[model samples]
Target: MGPWQLSVSALAQPDKISHLPLRWIRGSRAVMAFTVSVFLSSILSVITAANPPYPPSTVIRKIVWAPVDTITRKAAGSDNLPVTWADDEAIYTTWGDGWGFEPRVPNKLSMGFARIVGAPGNFTGTNIRSPAEQLGGGRSGRKGWGIISVDGVLYLLMGHADRQGGQAQLAWSHDHARTWTFANWKFLQFGLMGFVNYGKDYKGARDNYIYSYSHDGPLADTPADRFILMRVPKNRITERGSWEFFERIDETGHAVWTSDSKRRGAVFYHTDGCLRSAMTYNAPLHRYLWWQQIPVPKGSADRGDTRFEGGFAVYDAPEPWGPWSTAFYTERWDVGPGEHGDFPAKWMSEDGREIYLVFSGNDSFSVRKATLVLAQKY
Candidate 1:
């Protein structure tokens, strides 16, 4: 946090400045060294990475690890799912294809479903028997969704992209993950701009509605879009009329909510994109934890390390419509670019000290899961 070294050997000397060490003069009398402090500060920022503590151990699970050169076998796989549900019985994940983009046909693809029984360490991994089954109409964009449970009901905030572009819709499941019944309704209209990629969905005991979010802009793993927010009343899942758009918070510190769906705005903006996002309420910290898998590209604008720009980052905020701040971040992850990283609610602790990170990528078989020790809250 102090006393960083700056090398000026490679820097060109300024013309007008007089001081030997460097020009400390004001106005246009500045030299090229004017930017030296700015460069060094950027270095210090990476040195002082605001990363949460790493987990004690990282556990890997394969929902369907099919070798690239398989004979008569098709590895069961579906790794990307913003909708992750967990319980004492089992941990359930849905959406995305574990098979990747193979077969190239896209004709027989189904929304992959999987289950990990027991708990994190003692989990049974995947049963691996007939790992995937068709969900919905199997339309290409029908699988993008954000799911949350209010009381005993589970709500799925599904998004789609057709020839006409993007849109968002809703559905509910009463029998856990065994079956899903889609609401004959539209949450966000066809031309509603963002909220097309609802990464994480949340419900608060102190609040009356369920909150949802999205990160859609430019491309995946780069600076593009911010975290967009939306919500619907708990009592009105069936009533599309109950959905409300989050405008912004007022000066007095109260959240401003309105029924006009077109009022949607990005509560938190980031360049990270192109995948599912995970969110949950951390009771001990009194904040929301947003876990997103952002692939730091080769020429990505570096916030810290140029070689490694984005990976899985933990962003914390006091409100759902976040005045959010970074709690922890990393430039390294096991999955490749455009991959997704997520934290299942059950694997996270109430104090925000420990977490299990899940990673899934393009056309791979296994889903990489790591149990990371979160940085102790300072």
Candidate 2:
């Protein structure tokens, strides 16, 4: 038998060792002690493997929020803000379940597009009354959770088209947010999807493929066990067959992809599960930033009123499929960061240190400035 097995077997039969030579007995005791140490270490190794520490992010050290100048210009109950920088040096976004912008729309809409022009500190939003926009209320009303601009074409990833949040489809607009054409095919598997945005018209993209992330669930409001990633050629976003899912991270730390959606693997995990998120590429820093809602406590009264008071978390990574590190986290905040949050690429400073976060805080369109604290390099 192997030494470890022999030592274990010897310990189980104490009577057999009682008659051994004095010197030999002493030697056996030494071996037994060594064996026990090894045994305990093996068990501890397994335990540590199952529960690893939070991975340290090599890029961002932390994020500092500037609350003094934070801006929240309410548009009378508007929410669900998903924005993308366009080639025309403006941000086109969509709002849900309210009158949009100033001089409010003639009617409340479940989904309406608006164009935001000017700097983050001073900007004006004008509502677009497109014939394609949906008007109504409640969960049955369609809304957009993600939007991106590629090559001057605005693509919006919308959910609840089939009278439920589980069904999602894509719609494209050539004239900014004025009009749109919805794709016939729908995605019933992933409802909450967010595109990895870059500079205006996707100018700072790392590759030709466009990447997107979603909770591994069918419902938009519900959290999933983990996050799933998908990608398609930048030119072929409308082609269902051209899309690929992240299957696994290879040994070299690079992501492996598969055409079969069923074989997809998780790219990241969170204690509270994955929910609606906003991801953007920090061009100057060469990192990807992901912002997610920190869900309200399950049994708390605030759970029902997260619009005014809630929490959020921000993570940064070298790539989209990340070894993510926390840039900021809060279990709860006085003024909730809102259910939907995004950092538009246009407002980022040249060094990528100063930026603005746009969210639906206080149940309206909100903007807050934040400075990135980069990790010091020796």
Candidate 3:
């Protein structure tokens, strides 16, 4: 009887309130006041189910206007070009052949080459490519390409022809923009290889991965180079599936994967006699690769100019591999003085909020979407 006086004699029991009678002690004081009001409503529902309400924003609802046709002007007339966002919303551009095959298509058979499918919202300048029998034709051309949509399906990462004949080819797309199903014509044996880019992480329930690279050797006549990390399984986009290579570092002809608000992971490339331009992050100690000597300011890789110039510069990463930090510079509104240029940019929607900048301008090659808003703390 000393444990705090036996809890004050168990609340001063009068035979523990006797077998309560007297209208059962007024219905036991209304059943002990409804069990202390359901124990304070379950402690306020476990403190509002452990907090999370909303405070971090970037909104630009819709501005999709893609239609610069003539088979995207013979696939942007070839040279490190890229445009991706295909699930049926359409927009998948690619270009190469700066050297390999010489007939860069585009002589109007509806435009020698093709791969266009507009009609998502506002690309109504009209050119809508999509016809050459759903765009097919393979030689040892078509460089650095990577397009992903996984669950809704649409996967293409090219560099085809090899089977003792040469290397590169891993394509997939299931009847939406028409047809394409080549599971492997030579899925990465590295040779003049150039899928030079691709990155996706999705977060949370986890299951979204596609990191493709290679643009400087194995087939510019075998120099033996390396860079691979492909694990795209958000539901399946086949290549016999199952991949994991990670870490080979720069052969750089092109590679962009951004995100850096401290979630970590950054990579920007082009260092193989493209002269130079680099950035890397995935650090705890190592993985910090660097070589950005800065010197892209002469007509900013010109092509005509309608505003927004050149390309390469992406930032936003929590983990695709990084220790990055550079908020915005994907051609930062084509940077100062007379502004009207912005080139080959990508990172078109990933919580960092849409940024699909492309520019060769007026003569045609304009694809823009820069909607990123993040500034709030109170």
* Global lDDT scores for all candidate models: 0.44, 0.76, 0.33
lDDT of residue 358 for candidate 1:
47
User: What lDDT does model 3 reach?
Assistant: 0.33
TM-score per candidate: 0.61, 0.83, 0.24
- Cα displacement (Å) at residue 144, model 1: 3.9
Q: What is candidate 1's lDDT per residue for 135-254, written digit by digit as tens?
A: 343234345445555454555555553312245556666555556676665643431122211112333344666666655432222343345566666677578777666675554445
Q: List ranges where model 3 is wrong by over 4 Å.
A: 1-157, 160-244, 247-316, 321-356, 359-364, 375-378
Winner by TM-score: 2
Which pairs in model 2 have colliding backbones?
A: none
- lDDT accuracy of residue 18 in candidate 2: 24
Candidate 1's displacement at residue 35, Å, is: 28
Q: What is candidate 2's lDDT per residue for 8-89, written digit by digit as tens? A: 4454343323222122224335334323332432333243322211333446667788874467565658988899999999
Worst 10 residues of 1 by lDDT: 53-62
Better of 2 and 3 by TM-score: 2
In candidate 2, position 311 carries an lDDT of 75
Q: How many angstroms is residue 119 displaced in model 2 relative to the true structure, after the best TM-score fit?
A: 0.8
- Using TM-score as the measure, what is the rank order of every candidate, best first? 2, 1, 3
Ranking by lDDT: 2, 1, 3
